[model samples]
Target: MRLVFGLVLIIGVGLAGFAVFMAKDYIGAYQAQLDAERAARANAVPTVEVFVVNRGLRYGEQLTEADIRPVRWPENAIPDGTFRALAEIFPDGEKKFRTVLRAMEKDEALMQVKVTKPGADAGVSSRLSAGMRAFAIKVDVSSGVSGFLRPGDRVDVYWTGRGASELGGGTSGVTKLILPGVQLIAVDQIADSDQSAPTIARTVTVEVTPRQVAALAQAQATGNLSLSLVGAKDDTVSDAVEVDQSEFTGETVAKEKEVCTVRTRRGAEIIETQIACPE
Candidate 1:
């Protein structure tokens, strides 16, 4: 009887120890799962639905229902001038009536600068700022920066023409910088600044002030206008640039020869004198 009681007591203690170990493992697994879930929630980024282009759009292309759709964009990554609701952009059932000002790739967000006002198309007149005028100039393969010029590029305008000689002789050829940091608004009839490749446009339009318009008009009429491409971020004003034929050919301009002469006076009789002139 004593051996039986001892065996029963040992069996009960072993079962209790096993139950404790199993309970500890179960609790540890539950805690690990909860920690994992909390971490995932904390690392998640918030997103919102905003309209994006479903198809690539070019300038003057009309925006329709099929062209745009809503997609999830991170709230923190949302760009400015984006529309969150369709009604705000189209104003109730007018999706196919608006035009785009600039080109947009697929999935690109619609911004204020990329689109035109309601019921308006992309044109040169629409892009002009207040008190600004659009001036057009003739361009060619050589004068137009080898057809690499595009809208939104900056250019320096150089005028080449004949100017009256200071020596009162015939006109002399002259070339000088007339305008700098001028913003190009269009290449030919295309006002969009989103050109993918260089093209040779016959005409280029630039945005200018009224005073600049006058200057550019006279310069274009009197001389051949040439465009010089400026740096993308360049704001440095260049020094006065003027070049003449002598300067271009790097020839030493000659100075007039100095001469010496004397005047002869006669009493009641005029005397003729042939002598060297004074300097």
Candidate 2:
């Protein structure tokens, strides 16, 4: 009876030990599965190649592909084809990373001009080739008129001057007339891409042929230049009628009329009255 009891006890302990072993094995499998799930979750986030570089570069600074290195992926990533981010990604170099740009143009002077650099006085993409006529007139476009004005905003030129009144009161007045087909050679003042509350300048320089430049200079010396936004599709220059009325005296019409005076001996007399008008 003792041997029978001992055998039964051994059998019971053996079964308990097997159950504990199985439980441990199951727990190990579960832990391994959890670890794999965490690893996959970590890798699921997409990582892109970003460039980190030093800054404060001149227009023609030499930068190799090695000068720029890949950085940690950022959330609000820059788009694939924008040139604006080049300077932002590579600020003054001490505070943040910068990205340098290479010139596609062969001209050294043109290459040295940092088109991407901001602030007023940045050269317009409307380049001035040697002997090409350009006008040095000021243009005032409301910064609020559009989100921003880049080197390439198409604009229509308008003039505010004294001219014969389109309204026929036999009078003249200061009038704002659309110059019709004048093209914006360049946006004379470009607000810095990195600044707030961009400013307006007295004159925005424009590129014109020699004749146009002459006409523009005359206009600037005499009349006011205004710009109307034409948007992207309307950059074409149409036929324009330009006149020189710089020496306007007042806002009235120039009239020559005959006045009849009945007197004892006089029959009729004609008199001329000059009316100055605004354009």
Q: What is the C-alpha lDDT of each candidate?
A: 0.86, 0.49
lDDT of 2 by residue, 124-236 (tens): 43244466655655544452234344333455666656665453433233435344444443444542223344445445555556776666666657666666666666646
Best model per lDDT? 1
Full-model lDDT, candidate 1: 0.86
Per-candidate total of colliding backbone pairs: 4, 31
Best by TM-score: 1
Give each prediction's root-mean-square deviation over alpha carbons.
Answer: 5.1, 12.2
Report residue 253 deviation for candidate 1 (angstroms): 5.2
Which whole-number lDDT from 0 to 100 does residue 49 have in model 2? Answer: 49
